[model samples]
Target: MTLPPIRFTADEAWALAAALAAADACAPYAGAARTAYQKIAASMTGPVSVAARELAARIVALPSRTDAAVRAAVEEALTGNKALRLSSVDAEGRESDRVVEPAGLLTADGRWYLIAWCRTRRAGRGFRLDRITAAAPTGERAQPHDLAGLLLGSVAAGAARPVALAALAPPS
Candidate 1:
């Protein structure tokens, strides 16, 4: 018996291309689908596709992962599902106390951003990892929130905001 060739629509093809291009392990399949991938990539115009492509470029350009301290903080918060007390300075040079339930960590444009549920603002906020002077586990489990929703909300809320590192601060 012979099987019929499978066919994919433009949307499906585009999704497959993006997935393959975003992963190093899929390089072989990506090479095989080069032509289709290019065509789909070039034709991408939807908001989601455009955002995804832009993010993919940034991820590719990142020099390295977040620093060891930031990585450790994020790991502890995520693993324990706990709130992180962050010592951070805002753009206006105001030092603030922020307790957040970390939702996710993302690297874009050679920087790390932490998406979290801010207890102070009573809303979701994204903080630049470099700007965080210190992060300590609160030892209190976080109140559950929809992490995927928070991340998607961050994208809609403009993930390009300029947040800077605290000047003259020691690592915590």
Candidate 2:
């Protein structure tokens, strides 16, 4: 079924507004995107159906119970003066050095990523920090773009294609 555009009830509108305000006041991080979208969508007068409201509610509610330490780390990574040299193995199994100016840290689908401007790639790219063996301050830094400036929207996560997993019968 096709998802409808988000519409909000009075409570939803108020909640969303508060969420956006909190997000703005808190820090520039990836956790706030859903809330930000909800707040903005709530204010609009349109046909926000039950499905849309449910989706918005899920997004708004996702951030409430995260660990404090992880959250702090994200805030620091986004706003701190640090250039992390990320190492990755490409599809060709080649090691690469990606010098990036981290703008934010995004956690989605149980994965953490450093959203930064890749100096080598000469564009904005999301680097999975788990693959990074080293992250040290270069002592030289670049100005970070504002959250909205680097607004990737849905592009940050690529398209998902279905994959099958096979299970074998136990050996006798």
Candidate 3:
């Protein structure tokens, strides 16, 4: 037997699309919202059904939680000038130690990332919060570093240049 066709008005379709995008944005960070996204996907029947399903799948694949101890340590470090000793695993599966001056914590795509000045590496590094097994205060004060410059430099390198509105306008 064939299923009945589902229909939506143009406005309704636009509203659904916006809702789906919102759900996608929240799903990575919020467990309850991820469940809501699944429910929304279930209700979708026609044109937007595939898009909803894809968004739901993407949300399901994201990491759900950050370690409590690691999070607390990072938060504490953010409030002070002390350096932290972070025990983390590398991409190669080998564990390593890093003494970092905590600059900030950023959440992207449902995961927490630590942007810090790594004294060991002599540069800034972004470490995934989940991978940090342990965080301890070093008691020693952090040296002055250009945290904003490092973060902005990394973003500028890959970001697309902005276009001027006049360039897009046609002369009368």
Clashes of each: 0, 1, 0
Better of 1 and 2 by TM-score: 1
The per-model lDDT (C-alpha) reads 0.64, 0.54, 0.64
Judged by whole-model lDDT over C-alpha atoms, candidate 3 comes out at: 0.64
The regions of model 1 sitting more than 4 angstroms off are 1-67, 156-172
Q: In model 2, what lDDT does residue 38 have?
A: 57
Residues 101-155, model 2: lDDT tens digits: 7776665555555677778977777755445544555556666654334545646
The TM-scores of all predictions, comma-separated, are: 0.50, 0.42, 0.52
Overall local distance difference test of candidate 1: 0.64
Candidate 1 lDDT, 47-165, residue by residue in tens: 64565466446544223333446556766897689999988876787888889998766556544667889999998887876667778888999987765577664454544332332
Best by TM-score: 3
TM-score of 3: 0.52
